[model samples]
Target: MEWSVTNLACRRGQLRILEGVTFEVAAGEALILRGPNGAGKTTLLRCLAGLTPPLEGQINAPEDTIAYAAHADGLKAQLSVAENLAFWAAVFESDRAHAVETAIATFDLETLRDRRAGALSAGQKRRLSLARMVVTGRPIWVMDEPTVSLDVENVARFARAVEAHLARGGSALIATHIDLGLPTARVLDISPFTKLSGRQTDDPFEEAFE
Candidate 1:
């Protein structure tokens, strides 16, 4: 599936988070949304996922075709790893035994399948949230800081999972300060679009603290 955002703008209360943001993404292509804090990366991702609507613009996407993994792990924490996958499998897609098992193994969660999500460490919870994407099997993924708390090994694993998804013709829009190893990604810097006049600048992060 193909997704497009044209002159998208969003506001939270009186604050304008994003404005005049335009971009397009197609299957097998990934775009990295990069910028300093408060650059609206997560806000833009939320707009694309339909969690929040844009003030003035157009987003062409399939209904619920996008899977979103926010900064919060979004896991029940009370539910076991297997149970969490089961619940999402039932909610987002069909309740298929094989699919859940495949996702568990794909994210390397088999060892902690029966463990409660709350019992898992920060990194494992991130992995569990990512595994939800595998269960949904959707064409578009909007992930916000997906690699947070992950170590070197799991970060590599997450990169491989992204590669496999892209190889299978899926599209992704990832908002991150850390790299996800995308070699051919087009970078979109949303900092310039901020409505905060004092901070507006042509360069993505010029004068912005690193």
Candidate 2:
């Protein structure tokens, strides 16, 4: 599948944060978003994920094909790691047993499968949160700061998971400040699209790739 955004504009409340943002990610590819804080990376991802509507322009991707993972680890604190993934698999109407088992092993959560989410450490919780994304079977993963609390080892694990996903013809749009170790992923810096005080630029991409 190919994800394309053309002449995209995004806003937060009354303020417009980005405009004329355009990009495309083909199947088996990844795009890494980079920019200073408040540059609309999250807003753009939210717009693509259909969590927030674009202020203007079009996103050519089906809603059901995208899986979004935001900064918050959307996990029920009382639920066990395995239980959380199992619940998501069932919700997505996928192969619940296979999804749960695959996700557990993907994130190295097997040992912590029976432990409650609240009892896990920050890294563990982040891992579990990422595991949930796998159960959806959605091709496009929209992730925002996915490695928040992860250590070096866990970061590598996450990178491998992303690579494996791409190898399976899946695509991802990741917004993060740190390097994800994906050498082949294209970079989209959101600085040019950031809204300025008092006036909006007529052309946001004139210097976009510079």
Candidate 3:
């Protein structure tokens, strides 16, 4: 499905962080969000994923269609690498064997299959978290800084996965500060949409009158 956002306004605790944001990602395409810290990249991704609501405007996509990967690795520390993927596969109602195997191979987690999540390094945990997104088989990926702790080789693997997903008519909305090596992907910088001074000028004339 094609994802579209129109005049989106996102807020954090009554603080308007982003406004007048608009974009679209058609099936088989990827859109990258580029901006510095506190530019509402994460907030925008969360709003798209339905973890939070947009303060205004509309998102023309269903929440269930999105597979969101936040900065934090949302893995069960006690579970083994394979077990983590297996658990998510079951949750997503996918074929446990196939999904788990695909995820492990895609993220190069085969050797760490038996290792507990807590035992893995920072990069390993991030890899597992990314693999979970793959197991869900969701059409739209809303990832926030997906390459946080990944090395160069693993990042390449992630790029391949994204390309393969798009090749299969899937779409992605990624928020990252680094280059994801996706040449064809469109870029959206969130800085322009950020609200300054925690206030919005609803009416230019009103401010003058005041």
Candidate 4:
């Protein structure tokens, strides 16, 4: 599936952070997002993921094909690693016989499959969160800083999983500072579309108003 965006303008409350953004990610492709802090990289990804509505423009991806992974790893603290993946698989109706198992193996979580999310170290939780993406079986992945708590080795493992997804005609749009080692990935700098109206303060939530 090809994901396309055109003239996307977005805001956090009344403050416009970005405007005139346009991009496309074709099947088997990856698009990396780059921008200075407060340039609306996360805001743009949220709009693409449909977590936030754009003030203007068109998103041409299929409604249910997008799977989003945000900066916050939204794991249920009480759920075991396996249980968490199972829950997401059910949520996305990904009834592929081995969906949950596949995800566990993909992220090397087999060792911790029975561990509660609250008990895993930061990197382990991050792996589980990304593993949730695979269980969803969505064609397009929209991730913001997905490598946050991962070590170099884990990051490479994550990159391999992404490569496998792309090999299956999946696409990804990611906002990250570190290189994911995706050889064919293209980068799009969002600074050109940034609007300073919401960047005056250092707080990311400051855009809620002025």
TM per candidate: 0.90, 0.92, 0.91, 0.94
lDDT of 3 by residue, 1-210 (tens): 688999999875546788999988999999999888778888788788787789899999875798999877999999999999999999989899999999999889999999999999999999999999889989999998899889999899999999989998999998877888998999988889988446555665323210
Pairs clashing within candidate 1: none
Each candidate: what lDDT?
A: 0.83, 0.88, 0.87, 0.89
Candidate 1 deviant stretches above 4 angstroms: 197-210
lDDT: which is higher, 2 or 3?
2
TM-score of candidate 4 versus the correct structure, residues matched by position: 0.94
The TM-score, computed over Cα atoms with residue i paired to residue i, of candidate 3 is: 0.91
Rate residue 30 of model 4 by lDDT.
94
User: Per-residue CA lDDT of candidate 4, range 1-210, in tens?
Assistant: 787999989886557888899888999999999988778888888877787789999988878999999888999999999999998999999974499999989999999999999999999999999999999999999999999989999999999999999999999998888999999999999999988564345565645321
lDDT score for candidate 4 against the true structure: 0.89
What lDDT score is found at residue 147 in candidate 3? 94
Sorted by lDDT (best first), the order is 4, 2, 3, 1
Which candidate tops lDDT?
4
For each predicted model, how many residue pairs clash, with residues at least 3 apart or on different chains?
0, 0, 0, 0
How well is each residue in 1-210 modelled by candidate 1, as lDDT tens digits?
Answer: 678889999754445677898889988888988888877777788778887778899888878789999877889979999999988888887556876897898889989999999999999999999999988878898898899999989988988888888889998898888777778777888888877433344564332222
RMSD after Cα superposition, model 4: 2.5
Q: Whole-model lDDT, candidate 2?
A: 0.88
